[model samples]
Target: MTAIDILGIDIAKNVFQLHGADRRGRPVFKRRVMRDQLLGVLSGIEPCTIAIEACTGAFCWARKFEELGHRVKIVSPQYVKPFVRGQKNDGNDAEAICTAVRQPHIPLVPKRTKEQQDIQALHRARQRLVNHRTATICQIRGLLLDRGIAFGKSITKARRMVPDILSDMNNELSEMARDAIAELWDLFCNLDRRIISFDKKIEAVFRASPTCQRIAKIKGVGPKTATAIVAAIGDGREFRDGRHLAAWLGLVPRQHSSGDKRVMLSISKRGSQHLRTLLVHGARAVVRTAPNKDDQMNVWVNDLRERRGFNRATVAVANKNARIIRAVLRTGEPYRAAI
Candidate 1:
């Protein structure tokens, strides 16, 4: 009997599809197992490489398989998609994973530690609350507009004007309408409090982690950005270099070049959208203040802004910052300010 060189498991909520392949990539066994039997089946097989697609529970399964004395590779679903043959059933999906894992050049998602997951969860929860707050603000503004009471788009303006408008019984708002708007206002305030609470939690995490504090030393990177980067990439050892880290964050330009001609577009916008947003927002803040200072970094920022315009300059700063952050994490050295 040939040894199973690689086993790909297409995991779902209940059922799981397993595709085992030999050294030559020939299918040795194709089986389906329930959630209860998954570990039992894998435990019986001789230790080999297990390939799984990156998803909600992929990391947990990877850790389990690693404990079972088998190597695990979490391939991105996009990489597995192109390898699927014929129909798109569970067996085929599992086979596609096996095929995708065979290619050594394909980039693999790093297995995140439990601590990293916890930090990521905090960021996610905070972002969700922020989104809810924004929606609440918009609703409050829109309701006021319907009653012929309008204010500036700024959130501060909405917060102040809403209460004033609610108190003044001189406008078009009826009793029922006023009560409804008042409830939304309460919700807005509640969301604000929740978001603030999350902010403090993240700040605590940042303060406690020496690595996060070190990353925060980069001019544009604040406590939030530092924490987010650390949560997403841990110590950054998996990345080859700064450029590799930047590319992974989708800061690198998209290419459409063929043959001798070269065509470059905007940033690829891959990977974690939240991380990319934080980096870009921080860079934008830096770019906005660059004109006021004469520091070495600001000088370059000003020159770039003059040459490429404001938006491009902001992205360039973000890309540069991402690379710098990767170096800081990888080297474990303190970030030095440009004199």
Candidate 2:
């Protein structure tokens, strides 16, 4: 066997496809192996640079390969797509990964620790619960509206009206309808409890992580955003600079330029949607409250709001915050409020 320098594995639940190349990038071997025999096969081969797409179970496999003395690189699926040739299959995908890994400029996905995955899972759970709660509220409102009962947009208002409508027999609601609404109300409360529980868990994580604490010191960053950013990109080493971080979060404007003619559209809105949303929401809150403060950040925010309008200003602030967060993570320094 030629001395394999790079090996790419296209991983799946039950089967694995591998493509190997020599130091000169010539294909050495391509084969398929059962999941159970994967480790045994790799253990026999000389230790080499292994590349895999960053997907489910990728990190675990990367850690395993690293322990076996192989240098592992987890490449983003998008980055590997361009290298794939011919029909798409496990074998072709593996080959593409092998090719992508050898490219000097191809950005590799950072290997996440188990702790970071756990924190990310918690955030995902909380987001699901929140969506369920919103759906429940909308369902309740729609049910009441059918009976000619209307309430304010606020969830609290809808909740308050539910009890009143159930108690008053004067309304058009049937007993069965009342029972159904009551059940939904109960569900809403349960979701609230679960979301609160997730929040507490996130808070505990924030309390325990000094990195989270340092990031949270920024004006627009709270416990949730702080923990999430840390979990998503630890130490900010993957990014070249703060602007790159902002670009990763899709906060920067999208460009469609050719030659000297330049055109820019809205934000690219790529990358982590959850982090982008939290940062934008936090920025919105800061903008709403900035009028009352005289701090340097607030003054700048207010001026931007007046010049760019509120919505544009909000996104601008979010972009700024993302850069600040990246800087703080890279430097391991706490944020200092501008006077």
Which candidate comes out best when scored by TM-score? Answer: 1
| lDDT for each residue of candidate 2 in 9-73, tens digit (9 for 90 to 100) | 99999999999999999999888999999999999989999999999999899989988899999
For model 1, the run of ten residues with the poorest summed lDDT: 104-113
lDDT per residue for candidate 1 within 1-339, as digits (tens), equals: 578999999999999999999999999988999999999999999999999999999988999999999999998898999999999999999999999999988888878888888999999999999999899889888888987888999998887788999999989999999999999999999999998999999999998999999999998899999999888889888788899988999999999999999999999998999999999999999999999999999999999999999999999999999999988998899999887
- Candidate 2 positional error at 102, Å: 2.1
Query: What TM-score would each prediction reach against the true structure?
Result: 0.97, 0.97
Scanning candidate 2 in windows of ten residues, the lowest lDDT window is: 158-167
* CA shift of 127, model 1, Å: 0.9
lDDT of 2: 0.92
In candidate 1, stretches whose alpha carbon ends up further than 4 angstroms from where it belongs are none
